[model samples]
Each structure stands twice: as C-alpha cells, then as structure tokens.
Target: MHVVATAGHVDHGKSTLVRALTGMEPDRWDEEHRRGLTIDLGFAWTELPSAGTLAFVDVPGHHRFVPNMLAGVGPVPAVLFVVAADEGWMPQSAEHLDAAHALGVWHGLLAITRSDLADPAPAAAEALAEINETTLGDVAAIPVSAPTGSGLDDLVTALDDLAGRLPQPDVDAPVRLWVDRSFTIRGSGTVVTGTLPAGRLRVGDELEIPSLGRTAGVRALQCLGRPVTEAGAVARVAVNLRGVPADALHRGDAVLTPQRFRTSDVLDARLDRTGDDPLPQHLMLHIGSAAVTARVRPLGSDTVRLTLSGALPLRVGDRGLLREPGRHRVLGGTTVLDVAPPALTRRGAAAERARILSTLDGEPDEHSELRRRGIVRKDELKRMGVPVTSRPVAAGWVVDEKLWAELRSRLPDVVARWRQANPLETGPPVDVVRQQLDLPERSLVHALVSPPLAIRAGRVVRDDTAQVDHLPAPVAKAVDELRARLAAEPLVAPDATQLAELGLGRRELAAADRAGVLVRIGDGVVLLPESIDEAVRTLRTLSGPFTVSDARQAWGTTRRVAIPLLQYLDRHEITERLPDDRRQLR
Candidate 1:
C-alpha cells in the first residue's frame, strides 16, 4: 500500500480531483462541504491497476489551516501537489510546498486542477518548475479536469508510476504510529488512525503510549477499511485499541514498541535553513502528526536546541518542521541530532556544543556516539539509535576509548595519593574512587583496572611497585629485614608467630599485601611477591604431572605454605589441578 498527502491552494480542485479518482468523498466534516473549503484532514483510498492501494491524506490549503495541512503531510512520504490552472501559482501553493519540502517528501506528482476553466499548460509547467527546486525533486505534472474527466486517466497512470517508485519501508523497524485522529466507536472501543511509515502492527500487539506511561493492545487492525490481522509500513492504518480511552488518546499521541524509544524533552537538531534572521524564542515543531511548542536556542549556524513542552519518543535522523505558531508559516525543516543532549550550564557551553553538533552528520555511528558520551549504558546508546557493534568495556556499560585511557592513567595517581596521605590504610574504597573520578557508577572503576594496578583482598593496589615505601620507620625496618630473609629463602614463608614477633598483625599484613610488600597466602603464610613465579620455574623442571608433596619439595616449603600457594596459582589459572591430586603448568 502507498500513502500520499495532497498539498495545494484552497478551491484548487484538490478535493474534486481526489473525489473523481477515488469515487469517495474526500471531505469528512459538514463544515468543509458547506463552506467548500477543507478545514481539517480528510482520508480516501482507491485500488489502482497495478498499485495495490493508494491512500490520499487530503489536507486543508487555507492560511488558517496550515497547521492542519502540515499535520496531514508530516508522516506521509509522497505527495500529490496540486495547483489551479486558472489561478496558476498561488500563496498557499508555495506555503504547502515549503511544508512538504521541509519534511523530506521528495516523491510526488503535480496535479494541475481546474483545467476546464483555463489553459492548463502554463500552470503545469510553472508548478513543476517550482517543485523541482525543493527536496521534492522532479515530478510529472498531470493537467486534469475532474468535471470533464479530461486527463484523469493519465493522472491515474502517473500516480501508479509514483506508487511503484515510493521508497520501501523497513517492516522490521520498531513501530511508532503517530495518531492523527482519535475517537470512540459505538460498537468498538477507541480507534486511532495514523500513517504507519515503517514497522509492522499486529492484532493483540501491546504498544506503548509513552506520555501516559501506559500500554494499549491492538484489538483490531484495518487498512483502507479492510480488517486485517496485521499491517506493514507505507500504509495508512486505523487501530482499535483495548486499554486506552478515546479521550486519553489525542492527535499527536504515538503508539510505539515498548522500550524501543527514549522519551526526551530536549533535543539538538540540524536546521535545513538558517535564515538571515535567527529563529524566534519559540516555535511549533511538527513531526509525525505532532505540533509541539518548543523553546529554541541557536547552537550554531545550522544547529538549534529545542526544549519541548512535553517529552516525545524521538530517535536520531528523524525529520520535523519548525513553524511560527501565530503565522502558521514554516521556518524550515529539522533533522534530529541528539535526543539526549547534555545540559548547557557553563559559560561558552553553547558555542562548544555547536562545534560538536557541526562535527556530526546526523548518522548514528558507534564511535562518534561513544566518543561523545564517555560512559553510558548499552541500552542508552541503542535507545538513541546508535548501533553498538563493538563489545562493551563493562557489562551493560560502554566507555569511550580515550576516556577509558584517561581513567586508567588517572586511577594510579588517585590511589597513590590516597595511600600517601593515609599511610596506615590500604587504597581508597571502591565507592571513594567512583566519586573521585566522577564515574557514573561504582562498577565502572573495576573495568578501568589495568597493568601495575591490582586489587588485593578486595581493595585496590599498585602491584608492580611496593607502595609500603611510605610505611612507618619501625614497621619499614621490620618489613625490610623480612624481605631480605624471604629473598634468600624464596618460599620459606613467615609463620604467624614470626609475623607477630615483628609486630605485623592482620591489619598491617593486609596493608602490606595491598602495597605489594608480600603475597599473603591464607592461614598466616606470607611469601615474597616473586616467590610464586620462582615456584613455577622450579616446578617446570619436574615431571609434567606432579604431586602436592612434589610441589612442596620444589618450593622447599612446608606443607601449609605450599598447599595455599598452589591453590592460589590454580585460582589464577597459572596451573591446572588434576583429578588425581596432581598439578601441572597451565
């Protein structure tokens, strides 16, 4: 199915052309028929020869109804731009074209209506020339008289070609159906209609109404008035909802795939046109049938910050239009850059933010996004439409490459400073390091640990350097003598009795281990830092599969010291423990 929006001047025969083509009335309201002016959006559909179904979202063309026109055209991808042959180019014609052009609607066919009243050749030529200059590119203009049926067949053929050429929609994409009309049905519950640009909608599908923090089930689905179990993209759909009331669902409300979108009030966008005059303090932003009042701040020559009155479920690269609410004039189009923008609080922040926005081309690349947000949740990047192909630095969290490097570098200094300032203590607690680095969460600090940095007894340590260098004079003297003794006797670990005699209690021993002064095998057996490596070297000379007693003899240590040391090596994967109580190098 294909959907197209009608854009042209009022009384330009847009509705007349639609009526003739579809054999259905395009105007729904009694006021529209009585006044002969389209006051709101009207819908009509017809089955074409080769095109399955072609739906027309008929829009009002008067200056007062420009917002209604924009709302109708916002979600549709293709258009049937109309112009009156008798009047040629009109004011509403230009304004409607601007709205469609700003919305990135490039696929279209021009319809020169009211051909019976005057010569159609001039209007067809002129309107085609005007539309070709916009994002609508080039379109075939058909001069048709609805009353006389002149050129009506040719218009249908042109429309069939346009339908065949419409861009394919991604059915696999998450559903975000923007409601254009919502009302209660007598027999059925609430019914909401919108253009399903992409993604599939199925009966019984539970979709989200983000603003209400609620979910609504798809009770029924209809396309072109035919009930169906499911519908795909590029089709106009009316959904019967089960949970939400008709009064609760309004125009501009969206039904979305749950958890697929992030609702944001602040946005950074790329403007299609940055005119000589700056944008106003406030403007109405229209996208997907939504007209929101937004506060604007120019971030750069082409970028602006928009703070919406309420949050909307938005993604990067989504296109919208900004309009002066009172004038109903479209200022320009907008391409969303960042849905989750940082707060601009400091001096010169907006200037710096503009520089960042300029570097982005609106495509959500992983490197560019991760590089911008140093530390972020994996889901946040996904919700913002960023593809995270690379592995995360930590579980459920992604860190920028440069930021990770900075964290690794700064952590050593932070731990060293903490140790130096408090000699009796181990390194700072994990929570302290998290706050000191201003990390988003506590676990991120653990992912930042690298070489020369280690954790001993659940506290951070500088493994390569013995930071016990800052120990008290008396303790330092005692530890130096013990180090010399262990240096000579590589694996004869100090017993608890000997440690107590040297005034080294559990706290002092724990501090020494965190400082890399010695390796504390459990059960009060302490060895020099390099004793494990020395034992591994000696064991390598023995048989491939060696006994516990063999390991004890190789290290020249007692059974107690050797058992715990071997277990530590096994835990670190330095050695493998055999089923037969034997050991071998891993």
Candidate 2:
C-alpha cells in the first residue's frame, strides 16, 4: 500500500477532492464538517488502476493548525498539493510548500481545485511555477471540480502514475512508527494508528515508546481498516496495544522495536537555510509528527547543534524543518548528522566540533565512523542508521578493525614490558592495559588480547611469558645452594635469618617453589622438591595414626618444621588429620 498526505491553503478543496476521489468522508469531527474547515487530520483510502491500493492522509491547512499538518505529512513519503483556481496562491500555500520541501517530499501531484469557477490553465501554470521553486520540482497538475466531478478521472490516473513510481519501503529495517492518533475502543483496549514506513509489526511483537521507555505488546493489528495478523511497511496501521494506557500515549509519540532506537535531546545536523538571514537562538523544530521548541547553535556555515526541549527518536539523514516560534515560518531544512552528539564544553570546542562535523557531512561509512569515535554501542549505530555489514570486534561494541589489529599485534610486547618492570606481579591489571591502549571500552582490550594473551584471575598475562623460567644469576645460584643443602639434610631447613644472608628472600623462595626446586613447609622453612614423597614413604613404615611428636622423631626435624609439613600433607590429601591431632594416611 502507498500513503500520500494532502497539503494546501485553507478552503482550497483538499477535503472535498479527497471525498470525491475515495467516496468516503475525509472529515471525522462534526465541528470540521459543520465549519467546512479541517481542524484535525482525516484519513481515506481508494483503489487505483495502476497503484492497486492508495491511502490518503487529509491534513488541515490553517496556520493555527500547521503543527497538525506537519504531523500528517512528516511520515508519509508523498503529497497531494491542492490549490483553488479562483484563489490562485495564498499565504498558507507558500507555508505548506515550504514544509513539504523541508520534509524532503519530492513525489507529489498538483490539483487546481474548483476549476469550474475559473480558468484552470492559468492557475495550474502559476502553481507549477511555485512548486518548481521548491524541492517538489515539476509535478503533474490537473484541473478538477469536486462538485461537478470534472477531471477527477485524470487526477486519479496521475496519482496512479505517482504511486507506481514510489520507492519500495524497507520492511526489514527497524520499526519507527510515528503515532498520529491514539484512542480506546470498546472491545480492544488501546489502539494507535500511524504510517509504518519500514519494518514489520506482528500480533505478538513487543514495542516500546522511546521517549518514555514504556513497553507494550501488539495484541492485534489492522491495515487499511481491515484486521490482519501482521502488517508491513508503507501502510497505514492501527495497532491494539496490550499493556500501555491510552492516556500515556500521545499523538506525537512513536512505537518502535525495543532497543533499536534511542531518545536523544541533542542533535548535530546539516541545516540548509532557506534565506541568508541568521537563524534565531530558539525556534520550533518539526520532525516525525513532533513539534518541539529547540535552541540552535550554529557550528559552521551549513551545520548546527539543536538542543530540544524534549527527546525525539531520530536517525541520521532524517529531514526536519526549523520555523519561527510566533510566525511559524520555515527558516530552513535540516538533515540529521549525529543524534548522540558529544557535549562541547571545552575551550574552542565548538569550532573543533564543527570541523569534525564537516568531515562527517560527506556520509562516512561505518568503519570511518567507528574509527573517529574509537568505540560505539551497537544500538547507537543502528539508531544512526549505520549498516553493520561486518562482525564487530567485541560484543555490543564496535571498534575500528584496523585499530584492533594494531593493538592486538602490540599486546604481547606490552605485556612483556609490564612483566619486566613488575616481576613480582602475576600480570598487568586489565585497567592498566585499557589505559595504555587508550581504548574507550575494557571489553575491546580483552578482545584484542584474548588468544595470544590470556586473562588469568583478572590479570592479563601472555601465554608464552606466563611461567617464571629464568631468574637472575644470583637468585638462581642461591636457589641451587638451598636445594643442595635441603637434599643433604632433608629434615633440617634453613631459618629466615640464615636464608636472608644467602640472598634467598621470600620472593625468591616463592619463585623457586613455583619452579619446583624447593618446597616451602612454613615461614622461612624450605625443603627439597621430593621431601613430601620421601616423608610419606617413611611414614608408612610406622604403625597406624601418628602424632606430631612421632613424625618429628621419624624425620629427625624439630616440632616447628614437623607440624606444617603434616598440615601440608593433609591439605594435599597425602594424610588425614584425626580429631585428637593425630595423622593417618588417606
């Protein structure tokens, strides 16, 4: 299905033309029908010969309700611009044209309404010339009188041609349905209607309001006023939400897939000023059915930073309009460059940021964006409409693959240097590595050092340098002397004072123990590596359970050395400790 919104001055026969074409009343409110002026949005659909099914979103044309008009046309891709032959062009016509142009609506049909009252040729020519000045370019114009039904067939044919040329909606893209209407039904609890330009909505799919962070489920779905299990893009859909209240959702709110979009109040955009005048500090921003008051800060000649009063779910390349608050006249058009912009608080930061934004204006690819930002969340990239065509280097984080490769290549050397400086530590802490690499996320550092370097007990250690192989020559000779002395007198171990004189301190003794050259039984007591085996062999020669005194007599060692050895053997499961402090083989 294809949807098109109406645009023109008030009393230009926009509603009348829609009623004649679709044979359905476009005005839903009695006040509008009685006053013959559309104050709110109205909807109708018809079947065309060339386009199959087309939906019409009839919008109000009064200056007081221009916000309502924007709500109707912002999500719709095409427009049906109306003009009265007798009126030629009016003030509202120019404003509507400016709005349509700023919104990037290029596909349209021009209708010279009430042509029976005046010559249609001259008015059609003038409207075409006006449209040519804006982004609509040259559009097909038809002279039609709703009362007489003259030239209605040609208008339908022209619309059919436009619909056939409309671009196909991306059904696989993330859902961002702007709710233009929300109400409650008798049987169904809450129903919200909007144009689904992309993505799919199913009966049981979970959706969220980006600004509010409120979640709801699709209990039912409707498209073109008919019930359906699912609805695709480019169709007007009414979703019956299960959990959300009708009062919580407003006309400007959006329903989207959870986590696919983010709400942001600050935007970095490219602004094309309609005139040469400098923009005001405050203006009305219109985008995606939302009218917000925003503060504008010009970054460069064509770039700006907008701080909105409220958050909006916006993406890169989205078009919006900035209008004066009182006059509501469009000052310029905007193309979103960055939705999640950095805060410019440093000295000369705006100029530097503007320079950076100027580089991003050319539509950099995903890799270039990641490289510039150093790190980005997956959801943030999706919200910016960036395509993730390749796998990320880390989970939920995207880094420049080239940068990751360089960091990975240097990890081993970095770890080796860190170990050389801090030999007593097992490895460098994870935070230290992250700081050294100047990475924004710790997960990226872990990913880069995963295979060649391993994280053991929360420290980064290289696989090749994990073991302490060769100590200093002095420590190595001291370890050999200690081992030879323990081998000669297995039960007699050196004390701390004697070992300190030999230059074998606790650190060197621990290193020797790790290297399997000595066994540390207690504080300052070192034994040969095979001391446990020889002691166990000798203990078996004794009878049943033995006491600490019996083990000391059997090993010819003092009670201090004998007690810790029995405990170590018990810990290693070589012997069991009894309730009376006796030991038995296990």
Candidate 3:
C-alpha cells in the first residue's frame, strides 16, 4: 500500500502541488480558503501509471501546528517532502522532517516547487541535500511549478518509482484508522476521514468508534472525488459513520476492529530529550496523534517506565516515540514493554526500573515478547499490525521450551520436598504446588502437574494418606487373621469391634475402605467374599422366598443382625423387596 504525505514549510506550495497533481482543491476549509493557508490535514488521491491511484496527505507545515503535522503523518508510510525553489529549507520544513523521521517514514520523493520564480538548481540542490541528511534523504528529488506545470512529469515519475518500492501494507491485518479529521458532510451525517492502516472498509462495515465506546456503521465511502465501494490500506477514506454523532468523533480518536486491541496501564519505553533540555522525571507522551501525561521513570540508563493515568490498549511490540510536555519535537521511538504493570511506589522505584531495563534488553522478537509478556490473544497482535509469525520476543525472558523442561524436572523435586516438609501429612494441594512454581499461564499448571505427586479420584489429592502402598505390617496381619476366622465360619463375618480387636485403627480402616480393600455390605457387620457366598447358599437351601423373621431364626441370628443383612442385600439388588415384607431373588 502506498500513502504519500506532503511535508515542508507552510505556503512552501504543498497544497498547490496537491491541487496540480489531483486537479482538485484539497483546501476545503472556508477559513483556509480565506486565509490562504493549509491549517489542518488535507487529503486527496490520484492514479499513477501501473502503481494505481495513491492517496496524498497534505500536512500543515506551520511551526506552531506540528500537532496537525503529526495527525497527517501518523498513518502514512511514505511522504512527499516539499520545498519551494524561491524559499528553500525553511524552519517548518525541518520540523516536519523530524516528525516524519521519528515516525519511521520511508519511500518518499522530494518536490521542489515555484521553479518559475527562481533558478531552481541551487535551492533544489541544497534542499535535496538537507532532506538526504535526515530519514527522507535517500528519496528521489523532483523540482516542479504548480502554475506552469514544469517538472510535473518528472514529479509523477518519481512518485511512481517510490510507490513501486514501498512495502505493501497487509490488507489481511487488523483494521485501524487514525482519524485526522471529522465533520458533517451535507446529507452524509457525520463524516470522518483518515488513512486506513490495513484491511478493507465497505459501505456497511461496522467500525468501533473507540473514543465513544460505541460502534458506527460505514454509510458511504469517497476518495479523490470518486465514489468507491471499498477502500483498502493506505487510502484516504471519508466514512459517513452511522449512529455516531459529530460531537462524539474528533481528531486522534481511533476507529478499529472490535475487541481486537486491549488497553494498557503501564508502558516500558525508550525516550530521549528532543533538545539539550534536561530530562525530567515526568513528561507528556504523544503517539498516533494522541497525547497524554505520563510519569517517566528511567530504567538503568536507556529505558523508561511510563505510568499513565488511564488505560490505553497497546500491543506488545508497537513502536511509539516520546514527546515531552509543550514540545513539538520527538524524544525517541521505542517498542512497547509490559502493557500491564503493578502500581509501584517510590520505595520500590529501583526495582521497577531494573525490571523495565531487563525487559527492554531482549531482542525485539515476537516469540520472546509474548513469552515474556505471558500470553497474547490472536486479536491483540492483529490490531497492532504485527504478524503472528514475526511477533517480537520480549528480551531477557525465558522461552517456553526451556521453561517447560525446567518445570517438568522440578516437579519430582517439589514432590520430594513436600513429603519431607509434611512428614505427618499426606501431600500438598495442586494449587499450592502451582503457586510455588509461579507458572506463567494458568493452563501450564494443568500441563505440569502429573502422576505420583497428584492423583485424581473424584477430585485431585496430594496427601500421602491418599497414596496406594502395601498395607502397614499391623493392618496386613489384621486382614490375614480376619480372613482365617471367616473361613472357619463361612456363614458369618467379623464385626467392626472384632476387626478392631485384630489391631487396625479406625483411620486405617477408613483408608482401606477408600482404597476398596475392605467391603462393607451391612451395618454393624464386616464381610469377606467367602462369608457372603456361604450366607447366600444357606438362604437358597432354606426357601425360594422367606420372611425376615423366618430367615433370622433359620440363620440362628437376632432380628437386629438379620434385618440389616436383608436390607443390605435389598440395597445391592441381590434380593428384591416383595409384597407383605417377604424377600426373594433367583
């Protein structure tokens, strides 16, 4: 996508050149028409051969209006640096260049205007040399006259050359529009315009008006005096927003994809003073035409922690330069650090500074950044125009592969330590282990927790009492004695009292029950498989169906013992309840 911004001093003939190229008046403001100055950002577009029609952002180069210049240059990737042949290398010209350079603009062409009034050679050479010294230094130069149309062909050719080499903006990336101007067009409702960073906008496309905290529909689209159905990246688009009022929209308000980006409270940045001015501990920050006050605390030497008053959704690797309070010039551009930070105090200032510096020291790569930042939703990366594959890695943080291996290796050690520390207890809870390790993602806890230390029944347990081990010596001997007693009297099983006599503690018996070691078939009775089978045989020989009292008498047991046994059988569906209190089963 090719978007060219017009730069140079005010009245250096930027608007005139735009008019000559597009054959349309970009200075549509009534005041601009009367005062004869480009007060705000003016946009127009025209088709160049093979490169297609390109949009041009005419920025105000007036020294006092650098904010307007930022509004224009914030979204465009390329620029048209204008310098009049009669008045070359003016102050505003340098300011505009600085803004563009801080914004990282490339693929620009030099347009030296008003050739008819002076010998264009000297002024053009000097102006071209000055531009070359800055970020736009390497761009092609063309000297032109808006009236006589001198050098118009050369100017067009230079733009075409730059357009051919400009990087293609990914239309599939997240949609973001930095609103440079907004107004009410007749019968069009509220119209807002700016460069669409990526993706397309159709007539009915719904845009989230972020400043208003609401969504507005695209009612219409117009570009360069022609109506288009859809506008793609790098195109200057006038959108008649439905449902949003004129007052709700303003310059610096962003139109973006819904829920794609999130707001941030703390920002780790790299900043420098614009001039020889002493760096203060606090300053103002300007990014994408938006300005806010931020407390600046330097980290070590290079990085700074910007604690903002309110949250602004920013991606992990978004690059933004700092601008101090009341200053029109740039501080420096820095990739973002932690978007979320705990509120810090003066006492912890040194620690916070160290953390910011450490985060900035890592190479700006996506994998490292996301890992360092913890987790990134697909939408956040999309909103910042950062490709998932090329995402920036936050420096000075461990990668997932190494982190996972370390976590796995540490689990066994953690379990052994827990066992030693809680000698009387079974084990620690899963959450306790997770907290101790300080896992990055909550999902990582699930990934790291495994067998031996953790076991799942109805719920996860960490205690040693829940473990599966051979019975204790006394409990094992008790079980063997009970089995022998039951084998001799196959029709009867030992009661809990008798089992207690065999030396198993109450807790130990309960643990055995939980482990399915001892079966409890009836109340106040303990039974093994042999005892249950012998009782069932005796009942079958006695009768096909029998009353509870008759069974108790035939088994030579009291009603208390016989009734519970009968109920236990009934509960297990071994014997079905019948009419008149009789019981029977095949």
Candidate 1 residue-wise lDDT at 376: 87
- Tens digits of per-residue lDDT for model 1, 1-586: 9999988868738898899999999899899889999999999989888988999999999999888888799899899999999999988898898888899888999998888899989998889888988998878888889999999999999999999988899999889999999999987889999999999999999999997898989999998889999999988999999967659888888999998888999999999873567679999999888889999999999999999998889989899999986765789999999999999999999999999999998888889988988888888888887878877777789888888888888998999888788776667788778888999877787888777776655667666755666465666777788888888887888888898889888877776776667778786888877887888889899977999999898778889888999998998898999899898998
Highest TM-score, which number? 2
Q: What lDDT score belongs to each candidate, Candidate 1 first?
A: 0.87, 0.86, 0.69
What range of 10 consecutive residues in model 2 has the weakest lDDT sum? 463-472
Considering only N, C-alpha and C atoms within 3 Å, which residue pairs clash in candidate 1?
none
Relative to the true structure, candidate 3 has a C-alpha RMSD (angstroms) of: 6.3
Model 2 agreement with the true structure over 1-586: per-residue lDDT tens digits? 9999988959639999999999988889999978889999999999999788999999999998899999999999899999999898888898999999988898999999999999988888988999998888989999999999999999999999999999999999889999999999987788999999899999999998775677889999999889999989899999999977658788888998887776889999998777888788999989988889999999998999999999998887888989885876988889988888889999999999899888775363687678777678766787677776657777788777777688888887877788788665556888888888887777877788776578865678656642434355677788777767878888788888879988988898876665456788787888886887898998999899999989999999998789989988988899999999898999
Clashing pairs in 2: none
Q: Backbone clashes per model, in order?
A: 0, 0, 22
Q: Any idea what lDDT model 3 has?
A: 0.69
Off by over 4 Å in 3: 184-191, 202-229, 240-242, 272-276, 325-327, 337-364, 370-399, 419-426, 440-443, 451-454, 458-586
- Please report the candidate that would top lDDT against the real structure: 1
**Residue-wise C-alpha lDDT for candidate 3, range 402-469, written one tens digit per residue:** 55577778876775677466432334456666677785444455556666445443222344442333
